[model samples]
Target: MKITLLTVGKTEDAYLKDGIEKYVKRLKHYTKLELIDMPELKNTKALTQEQQKSKEAELIMKKVQPLDFLVLLDEKGAELTSTQFAAYIDKRQIGSTSHIIFVVGGPYGFDASVYQRANDKLSLSRMTFSHQMVRLFFVEQLYRAYTILKGEPYHHS
Candidate 1:
């Protein structure tokens, strides 16, 4: 199965960019992983938080296919251990899920439409982190999950 990570805006921090690139390269050895950055909405000073989310949701939905299994990375989503995450991926593969799209929404989080479209939601941690920072954290966790799945030494319980 192919895994796609869709997030809004770019990663401007040099450290975060480097980390994200490293994991993306390492993840290629395990599965087809794609990271797509949706451009940030322009002139958001006048828009309310809901309005921003609405516009961002429109952009996000444009890239989603009808059959793709959408998963949102949100604070309120289910939290799982590294091994459990690997198991989740294995289950999806066995079920013949063509594409698993994990989305990181804009600062205000996802709109109601995006929430309704998602098949599942996952949380990296209970604490808050910047949206850009979350991109790096989630990618690293994904890599860790793969390593754990393969019984590699990268992850220790």
Candidate 2:
């Protein structure tokens, strides 16, 4: 199974880039992990929150493939332990999942249409995180899950 991380905006921090790169290299050992960066909505200060989400949603939806399993990373979504996440990955592979896409929406969150398209929702933390930070956290968690699955020393119980 392949995992694709779709998130809005670019990760500008050098530290975050380095950290994400580390996990991306590690995740390659287990499954194909691709990162898709959605461009930020331009001049959105004039638009209302809802309008901004609607505009961003259009861009996000363009990246969605009919066969991809859309999973939104939202604070309101189900939270899972690292082990459980690894199990989730194993289950998807067993079920012959072609693509698993985890999306991090823009600041105001996803539109109703985006939510409707999602197969599942997952939360990295109950506490809020910036969309850019979520990319790093999610990639790191993916790496940790693989390490747990493979009995590697990277993840400590």
Candidate 3:
């Protein structure tokens, strides 16, 4: 299955960018992966948080296709262990899923429409992290999940 990670704004820190790139390179051998960083909304000084989310939702939806399985990386979503997340990825592959889009919404989180369209939601942690930080964390977890699936030494219980 192809996995697409769609997030808002660019990852600025050199360390974070390097870390994410490292895992993404390793992931190339495992599956098709795409990283889409939608440009941050410009001139938002006048827009309300809800309005920002609404505009961000439009961009998020545009990347998603009708057949793609949308998974929102939401704080309130189901939390899974590394091994469990590996199984989740395995299950998707076995189920013949062609495309799975995992979205990291804007700072205020997803709008009602984005939530409505999601097929599933997953929480990386109960604690909140900056959206930029989330990008690195999610990619690393995804890489770990693959290694777990292959019984590699990269992950230990």
Candidate 4:
């Protein structure tokens, strides 16, 4: 199964970008992992929060394929341990999922329309993290999940 992380905006910080890239490289060794960055909405100061989210959702939805299993990284979502997350990934690969897409929405979060399109929701932690930081965290978690699955020494109890 191919794993894709779909996020809005570019990683402007050099450190964060480098860190995420490192995890992405590691993930490629275990899975066909890729990052799809949606362009951030420009000149949105005049738009209401809902309008901004609507526009962002439109951009996000366009990137998704019909067969892709969409998973949103939402605050009000299920939280899984590293082992459980590894198991989940394993199940998807074994079940032959065509594509597994995880989306980190814009500042105000996803619109109702985008929520409707999601196949599942996952939360990394109850505490909030910046959008850019969340990207790095999720990618690292994904790399860890793969290492755990492979029984590698990268992850330990």
lDDT of each: 0.94, 0.90, 0.95, 0.93
lDDT of 3 by residue, 11-126 (tens): 99999999989989999989999999999999999999999999999999999999999999998799999999999999999997899999999989999999999999999999
Candidate 2 lDDT over 55-149, as tens digits, reads: 98899889889988999999889999999998988788889688999999999889999999999999999998877788899999898888888
TM-score, candidate number 2: 0.96
How much RMSD separates candidate 2 from the native structure? 1.0
Tens digits of per-residue lDDT, candidate 1, 1-157, equal: 8999999999999999999999999999999999999999999999999999999999999999999999999998999998999999989988979999999999999999999999999999999999889999989998998998889999988
Displacement of residue 118 (Cα, Å) in model 2 is 0.2
Using lDDT as the yardstick, the better of models 1 and 4 is 1
What is the number of backbone collisions in each predicted candidate, taken in the order shown?
0, 0, 0, 0
Question: What value of lDDT does candidate 1 attain over all alpha carbons?
Answer: 0.94
Q: Which stretches of candidate 1 lie over 4 Å from their true place?
A: none
Cα TM-score per model: 0.97, 0.96, 0.98, 0.96
Ranking by lDDT: 3, 1, 4, 2
RMSD of each: 0.8, 1.0, 0.7, 0.9
Report the poorest 10 consecutive residues by lDDT, candidate 2: 88-97
